[model samples]
Target: MDTIPDNIILHPIGVIRNTTKQPFLVASAAGLTMQGDLAPTMDRVRESEETISEVILKGEFTELLEGIDEYSHIKILYWAHGVPAEGRSLKKVHPMGRPDYPL
Candidate 1:
Protein backbone atom coordinates (compact mmCIF):
# COMPACT_ATOMS: atom_id res chain seq x y z
CA MET A 1 0.00 0.00 0.00
CA ASP A 2 1.12 3.55 -0.74
CA THR A 3 0.05 6.95 0.62
CA ILE A 4 -1.09 9.54 -1.92
CA PRO A 5 -0.02 13.18 -1.63
CA ASP A 6 -2.67 15.85 -1.63
CA ASN A 7 -2.32 18.28 -4.55
CA ILE A 8 -5.77 19.85 -4.83
CA ILE A 9 -7.57 22.05 -2.27
CA LEU A 10 -11.15 23.32 -1.98
CA HIS A 11 -12.64 26.46 -0.40
CA PRO A 12 -16.17 27.60 0.41
CA ILE A 13 -17.46 30.47 -1.71
CA GLY A 14 -20.76 31.42 -0.02
CA VAL A 15 -23.42 30.19 2.40
CA ILE A 16 -27.05 29.34 1.71
CA ARG A 17 -29.90 31.36 3.17
CA ASN A 18 -32.17 28.34 3.71
CA THR A 19 -31.01 26.00 6.44
CA THR A 20 -32.52 22.72 7.60
CA LYS A 21 -31.59 22.78 11.26
CA GLN A 22 -34.41 20.43 12.25
CA PRO A 23 -33.62 16.77 11.65
CA PHE A 24 -37.13 15.24 11.61
CA LEU A 25 -38.54 17.90 9.28
CA VAL A 26 -35.73 17.40 6.81
CA ALA A 27 -36.01 13.60 6.82
CA SER A 28 -39.78 13.33 6.62
CA ALA A 29 -40.09 16.10 4.06
CA ALA A 30 -37.44 14.56 1.84
CA GLY A 31 -38.87 13.76 -1.64
CA LEU A 32 -42.41 14.63 -0.53
CA THR A 33 -42.97 18.26 -1.56
CA MET A 34 -41.09 21.44 -2.34
CA GLN A 35 -41.29 24.60 -0.22
CA GLY A 36 -41.28 28.27 -1.25
CA ASP A 37 -42.82 29.99 -4.27
CA LEU A 38 -41.52 30.18 -7.83
CA ALA A 39 -40.34 33.49 -9.23
CA PRO A 40 -42.57 35.40 -11.71
CA THR A 41 -39.77 35.62 -14.27
CA MET A 42 -40.00 31.86 -14.68
CA ASP A 43 -43.59 32.22 -15.89
CA ARG A 44 -42.48 32.10 -19.52
CA VAL A 45 -41.77 28.47 -20.32
CA ARG A 46 -39.75 27.66 -23.40
CA GLU A 47 -40.16 24.65 -25.60
CA SER A 48 -37.88 23.09 -28.17
CA GLU A 49 -38.94 21.04 -31.16
CA GLU A 50 -39.08 17.93 -29.00
CA THR A 51 -38.98 19.09 -25.41
CA ILE A 52 -40.37 21.68 -22.99
CA SER A 53 -38.53 23.34 -20.11
CA GLU A 54 -38.95 26.32 -17.81
CA VAL A 55 -36.25 28.62 -16.50
CA ILE A 56 -36.70 28.72 -12.72
CA LEU A 57 -35.14 31.61 -10.80
CA LYS A 58 -36.30 31.72 -7.21
CA GLY A 59 -35.85 33.56 -3.89
CA GLU A 60 -33.35 36.39 -3.35
CA PHE A 61 -31.56 35.53 -6.59
CA THR A 62 -34.60 36.73 -8.56
CA GLU A 63 -33.22 40.29 -8.55
CA LEU A 64 -30.54 39.23 -11.04
CA LEU A 65 -33.13 37.95 -13.50
CA GLU A 66 -33.46 41.32 -15.23
CA GLY A 67 -32.73 41.50 -19.00
CA ILE A 68 -32.25 37.70 -19.24
CA ASP A 69 -35.02 37.32 -21.83
CA GLU A 70 -32.78 38.74 -24.60
CA TYR A 71 -30.54 35.65 -24.56
CA SER A 72 -31.37 32.54 -26.54
CA HIS A 73 -29.71 30.22 -24.05
CA ILE A 74 -28.70 30.34 -20.43
CA LYS A 75 -26.43 28.26 -18.22
CA ILE A 76 -27.26 27.50 -14.62
CA LEU A 77 -25.26 25.87 -11.82
CA TYR A 78 -26.81 24.48 -8.69
CA TRP A 79 -26.12 22.47 -5.58
CA ALA A 80 -28.72 19.63 -5.58
CA HIS A 81 -27.69 18.24 -2.25
CA GLY A 82 -27.84 20.24 0.97
CA VAL A 83 -25.42 17.93 2.71
CA PRO A 84 -22.43 15.96 1.45
CA ALA A 85 -22.15 12.20 1.82
CA GLU A 86 -19.80 9.36 0.98
CA GLY A 87 -20.94 7.98 -2.37
CA ARG A 88 -19.74 6.47 -5.62
CA SER A 89 -17.20 8.43 -7.67
CA LEU A 90 -18.12 10.40 -10.81
CA LYS A 91 -19.13 7.96 -13.55
CA LYS A 92 -19.13 8.50 -17.31
CA VAL A 93 -21.43 5.60 -18.11
CA HIS A 94 -24.97 4.79 -17.03
CA PRO A 95 -25.25 2.44 -14.02
CA MET A 96 -25.91 -0.50 -16.43
CA GLY A 97 -29.15 0.73 -18.00
CA ARG A 98 -28.12 2.70 -21.09
CA PRO A 99 -28.27 1.08 -24.54
CA ASP A 100 -26.14 3.84 -26.14
CA TYR A 101 -22.69 5.15 -25.36
CA PRO A 102 -22.41 8.32 -23.24
CA LEU A 103 -19.60 10.82 -23.40
Candidate 2:
Protein backbone atom coordinates (compact mmCIF):
# COMPACT_ATOMS: atom_id res chain seq x y z
CA MET A 1 0.00 0.00 0.00
CA ASP A 2 3.02 2.30 0.41
CA THR A 3 3.89 1.91 -3.27
CA ILE A 4 3.23 4.67 -5.78
CA PRO A 5 3.04 4.31 -9.58
CA ASP A 6 4.73 7.58 -10.55
CA ASN A 7 7.62 7.68 -8.11
CA ILE A 8 10.35 5.49 -6.66
CA ILE A 9 11.70 6.03 -3.18
CA LEU A 10 15.05 4.52 -2.28
CA HIS A 11 15.99 4.24 1.34
CA PRO A 12 19.75 4.21 1.67
CA ILE A 13 21.01 0.72 2.40
CA GLY A 14 24.38 1.95 3.69
CA VAL A 15 27.22 4.36 3.26
CA ILE A 16 30.96 4.05 2.63
CA ARG A 17 31.74 6.11 5.68
CA ASN A 18 35.45 6.72 6.11
CA THR A 19 38.09 9.31 6.93
CA THR A 20 39.36 9.17 3.36
CA LYS A 21 39.33 12.62 1.79
CA GLN A 22 41.09 11.62 -1.42
CA PRO A 23 40.80 8.69 -3.77
CA PHE A 24 40.86 5.43 -1.88
CA LEU A 25 40.36 1.84 -2.99
CA VAL A 26 41.80 -0.26 -5.77
CA ALA A 27 41.39 -3.95 -6.31
CA SER A 28 44.44 -6.25 -5.88
CA ALA A 29 46.12 -3.87 -3.48
CA ALA A 30 46.10 -3.49 0.30
CA GLY A 31 46.01 -0.30 2.35
CA LEU A 32 45.47 3.25 1.08
CA THR A 33 47.98 4.17 -1.66
CA MET A 34 47.14 7.61 -2.95
CA GLN A 35 50.30 8.93 -4.57
CA GLY A 36 49.57 12.63 -4.26
CA ASP A 37 48.63 13.87 -7.74
CA LEU A 38 49.79 10.80 -9.64
CA ALA A 39 46.87 10.90 -12.09
CA PRO A 40 46.22 14.62 -11.53
CA THR A 41 43.18 15.08 -13.77
CA MET A 42 42.05 11.57 -13.14
CA ASP A 43 42.40 10.33 -9.56
CA ARG A 44 44.43 7.96 -7.45
CA VAL A 45 42.62 5.27 -5.44
CA ARG A 46 43.59 2.53 -3.06
CA GLU A 47 41.77 0.04 -0.86
CA SER A 48 42.52 -1.22 2.58
CA GLU A 49 41.69 -4.62 3.95
CA GLU A 50 39.51 -2.89 6.51
CA THR A 51 35.85 -2.46 5.76
CA ILE A 52 34.45 0.91 6.89
CA SER A 53 31.06 0.55 5.34
CA GLU A 54 27.88 -0.91 6.76
CA VAL A 55 24.40 -1.80 5.49
CA ILE A 56 21.44 -1.25 7.75
CA LEU A 57 17.96 -2.47 6.82
CA LYS A 58 14.96 -0.57 8.06
CA GLY A 59 13.06 -2.40 10.81
CA GLU A 60 10.01 -2.96 8.59
CA PHE A 61 12.12 -4.34 5.74
CA THR A 62 14.18 -6.76 7.84
CA GLU A 63 11.65 -9.53 7.52
CA LEU A 64 11.94 -9.45 3.73
CA LEU A 65 15.56 -10.58 3.96
CA GLU A 66 15.05 -13.75 5.96
CA GLY A 67 16.58 -16.16 3.44
CA ILE A 68 19.26 -14.04 1.71
CA ASP A 69 22.26 -15.47 3.57
CA GLU A 70 22.52 -18.53 1.30
CA TYR A 71 23.68 -16.35 -1.59
CA SER A 72 27.48 -16.19 -1.89
CA HIS A 73 27.74 -12.97 -3.85
CA ILE A 74 25.93 -9.64 -4.04
CA LYS A 75 26.15 -6.53 -6.14
CA ILE A 76 25.61 -2.90 -5.20
CA LEU A 77 25.14 -0.20 -7.81
CA TYR A 78 25.42 3.55 -7.32
CA TRP A 79 25.64 6.70 -9.37
CA ALA A 80 29.17 8.08 -9.70
CA HIS A 81 29.44 11.69 -8.63
CA GLY A 82 32.19 14.42 -8.67
CA VAL A 83 33.01 14.12 -12.36
CA PRO A 84 34.59 17.25 -13.80
CA ALA A 85 32.99 18.69 -16.94
CA GLU A 86 36.30 18.65 -18.78
CA GLY A 87 36.93 15.04 -17.86
CA ARG A 88 34.30 13.87 -20.35
CA SER A 89 35.99 13.16 -23.66
CA LEU A 90 35.73 10.90 -26.68
CA LYS A 91 39.48 10.83 -27.21
CA LYS A 92 41.72 8.03 -26.13
CA VAL A 93 44.25 8.94 -23.45
CA HIS A 94 47.64 7.44 -22.87
CA PRO A 95 47.35 6.27 -19.29
CA MET A 96 50.20 7.52 -17.05
CA GLY A 97 51.43 9.43 -20.12
CA ARG A 98 52.77 6.21 -21.50
CA PRO A 99 52.20 5.38 -25.18
CA ASP A 100 51.53 1.73 -24.41
CA TYR A 101 48.56 2.52 -22.17
CA PRO A 102 46.32 4.35 -24.64
CA LEU A 103 42.72 4.21 -23.48
Per candidate, the number of residue pairs that clash is 0, 2
CA displacement after TM-score superposition, residue 23 of candidate 2 (Å): 1.9
**How does each model score on lDDT?**
0.37, 0.46
Model 1 bad stretches (over 4 Å): 1-49, 78-88, 94-103
Instruction: Put down candidate 2 lDDT per residue, 43-65, tens digits, no spaces.
Output: 33334334455556557777867
Point to the candidate with the largest TM-score. Answer: 2
- TM-scores of the candidates in the order shown: 0.32, 0.39
How close to the true structure is residue 73 of candidate 2, measured as C-alpha lDDT? 61
TM-score of 2: 0.39
- Cα RMSD (angstroms) for every candidate in the order listed: 12.3, 9.9
- Write candidate 1's Cα lDDT for 5-95 as tens digits: 7664534333343333322211122222112223321231111123443445445667677898899987655453543332213333232
Model 2, position 51, has a per-residue lDDT of 40
Clashing pairs in 1: none
